[model samples]
Target: MGVLSGVKIIEMVGLGPGPFCGMLLADLGADVIAVERPAADAGNPRPWELCSRGKRSMVLDVKKPGAVETFLELIDGADALIEGMRPGVMERLGLGPEVCLARRPSLVYGRMTGWGQYGPLSQVAGHDANYVAVSGALWLATQSGQQPDAPPGLLGDVAGGALYLAIGLLAGILRARQDGQGQVVDAAMVDGSAHLLNFAISFLPDHYGGSFEKARPAALGMHWDRPYLCADGEWIVIQAVEPKFYAELIRRLGLDQDERFVNEQRNPAAWATLGDELSVLFKTKSRAEWTRLLEGTDTCFAPVLAPEEAAAHPHNIARDIYKTIDGVLQTAPAPRFSVTPSAELVSVPPRGAHTKDVLAELQINSKRTGDRGQATAVGSPG
Candidate 1:
């Protein structure tokens, strides 16, 4: 049994982070019921939607006759409900928070959006890039007077949306359990993305006497934490920042005799030159050689690991960070527990594959259904 063993949640289906959130919840042993539109609306199935993994599915034509009642019936028994629709869409469909709360007072309602529920851009169509771009995140990437580089959508969608939503869901679950009451959790990507830059923002105040652009040369910036190439075309991250760590790095690199590289304060002016010198020195050694020299040391150094390499890492493999499900590789449940560990992946069902099972669990009759076959994908389940 997982920590969230008996918890039940109703997830209104949407793209991207919404489904990812539901997947995380379901992975933690919550009975996530993914409500999908009927075949009439989207007859062509989305089989390999990874978000639908670890969840049971129910198909309801919200536009049809009794679908609203069907949805409420599920919500009536659920402890939490997540939706990613626009602000007024759920209300228009007669499945708003107010109505759901009236039915189930202790139901934690989670709303996921790009701009949020009440902002001016609430109704606007946007994705991960748009959200983070406006939140000063995209603007902060350029170190020099160069064009801004897209940091990919992971920062906004996965980190900001999926991870934040999961945290909110868990926190909401805790509160609802302890107080016997539920509240709305608003997880906006823009808000989360902006909050992601909180640490960097702390150094940008006027009292700090310098802007973020000017502070790039500081020791705490990404310039110091970036990856460096090794002799074998592999990259390694060296965090020789603090005095002690820098001293250890110097010892590992056998550069103690270099007087200029020995002084931290004086090294700032020659950072570019020193960086080039260190890069050249690193290129003379392979990643394995550097690892052997600095592995257990306090140098704060690590090699850049590919996904496959990460899965087989000593620490990760010891902790069982990845698991195989139906012959496919995927991540295991995170945030381990001393007791009541999260359930391992038994099997993943296809999209709409669990319609009958879900409706049956809700004590609804599926016998009278027409020739509505189960929906499944080839590679993976969402």
Candidate 2:
């Protein structure tokens, strides 16, 4: 049993963050039942997909006559419920928050959407990048000359959308456990993405003129605190932006006596030239060579690694940051506890693979036993 063992969460399946939140809960030991549509395809079954690991799945064709009853039955004892749909879609299916809450009064109702339940753009069809774009997040990432590149949409979908919704759902569960009451968690992808821009937004003047033309306080800007390419073509990130750490970085680079680089209080003018020089200097050494020289220093340097590289890194391997289950590698449960740490990965089920078993546990059996589950999911991926 894991830390969230026995906790029940029903995820009304959708793309991106919805699956991700369900995966997080399942990883932490919740009985996450992904209520997928029978017609929905559950993407690839690769364990490295990261967000799709650690979930049990069921397929219910809600358009069928008795599917709504089945949904109500599944939610009777659920502790939390999450759905990512436009405003009225769930209501049309008779599985909206109000109906589910009426069935299970203590259910933590979580709604994930691009805009929100009610907003000017609530019904607009958009994805992660579009959601983050209107929130001023994409603007902050633009370089001095280049166009603002898409940030791969991770912030709004996974980090902002999924992670925040997971946290909120867990928090709501704790509160419901204490107060014998439940509440709604309005987790909007745009809202979460906007909240992530707190640092940048704070620097902006509310009135006017303090637009994107402004730099990021020099101390926090990407000019001096970004990735530089190494001789091996891999990137090493350096972020010693504080004065003391800057001094340390200068000393490590053997530039302590350079008059222009020494004046920490007024060095913004030289940032352009210094950044160019450091770029050339960094490219002179491979990532491995620099690791030996800067490992324990205050330079705040680290080599950027790809997913496969990260899984096999010495530090990650030493920390047991990832685990293998059924020959497929995946990240371990996180935010660890000393006394009640979470369980490691057991196995990742294929889509709709647990339909019969879960339905049997729910006492909704159609009396067929052996191989019935596999038979039902014959065309589904596992």
Candidate 3:
């Protein structure tokens, strides 16, 4: 059993972050039940959609007369509920936090959105790029004068939104277990993305003596810290921040005799020129040759491998960072525990695959609750 083996979560299935949060919980051993739309396209959730793994799926069309009540019944026994919708969408569906919390006093309600529930942009539509743009995260990704470019949707959706919502849900669950009072966790991509930028924001002023407006290209933009193309058109990145490591890197590259690199660590003006020189020098060797020379050294170097290439790398293979499940490649569950490591991932369920079993379990639970005079109403099939 995993650490969270007994925790139960009800996920109101939506796109992007909502499913991702459920996936995280499920991976950690929460019994996460995903309530998918009954009429959702069957061709959509392919096996490669890793977010749907380790979840029990059941279709419930809330627009049906009795479906809302059925959903609430599921909420009544759950420790937490995750929903990703606009500000008032849940309220319209009669499954809002207020109603769910009233029915289950200890329920941890996790709300995920691009802009929070009450912000000026709360009801406005947006995706990962737009949310990161508003949070000032997208701006930090650019060079001194280059246009900003985000790494697809990974930063804002998975890192900022889903991870924060999962953390908030877990924290709220702990508090509710102690005090028997539930609360809503408002997880907004805009807020979480801004929180993620705290490191860089503080580092700019405190460490670099620079502000965002007068942002000078620092370590991230410098030559030794970034990726350089190799002879075979592959790339490798090196970060030798400390003096010793930088000196070791220069020695390894036979650049100690170059006067242009001497004392260049202390000279910001020489960074660009040294970077260009290093760029030219790196292209003389293949990425594999550089990896052989620098990978295990204190110079802090790594080849820039693509997704498929990353899975095959010796280090990643040894660590089992990636697993192939039913012909689908996916990352393994992370932040492992010594006492109760997570189990191998189960197959993604088909929509409504567990409907009969879940409903039977709910019926048994309701009957037991009725014996104790605390029964909740369960809806009939629509």
Runs in model 1 deviating more than 4 A are 38-48, 203-210, 214-224, 367-382
Q: How well does candidate 2 match the true structure in TM-score terms?
A: 0.86
Model 3 TM-score (2 dp)? 0.91
lDDT per residue for candidate 1 within 204-277, as digits (tens), equals 77423466665542333332445689999999888666778787777768877888667742344667677777
Clashing pairs in 3: none
- For each candidate in turn, the TM-score is 0.87, 0.86, 0.91
On TM-score, the leading prediction is 3
Q: Candidate 3 clash total?
A: 0
Query: Per-residue lDDT for 1-382 in model 3, tens only?
Result: 5779999999877767989999988999899998765433324544225787888877666765566777888988899998887778888778888899999999999999988888677778889999998998888766666777888878889888999999999999999999999999999998999999877777776556777743434433566677899999999988787789888899899988887775777677888888888889999999999999999898879999988999999999998999888888898998799998987876778766776677677773323322221212222110
By descending lDDT, how would the candidates be arranged? Answer: 3, 1, 2
**Candidate 2 on 1-382: residue-level lDDT in tens?**
5789889998877766878888888878888888664433333443224555677777766655566677788888889988887877887778888888888889999988878888888877888888878987666656555666666758788777888899899999999999978888988888888888776756678512366556423333434587888999988888776778878888888888987677742355667777888889999999999888887788787878887788988899998987777776677887776776776676666667778777777787533322332221111110
RMSD of each: 4.1, 4.4, 5.1
Top candidate when judged by lDDT against the true structure = 3
lDDT of 3: 0.80
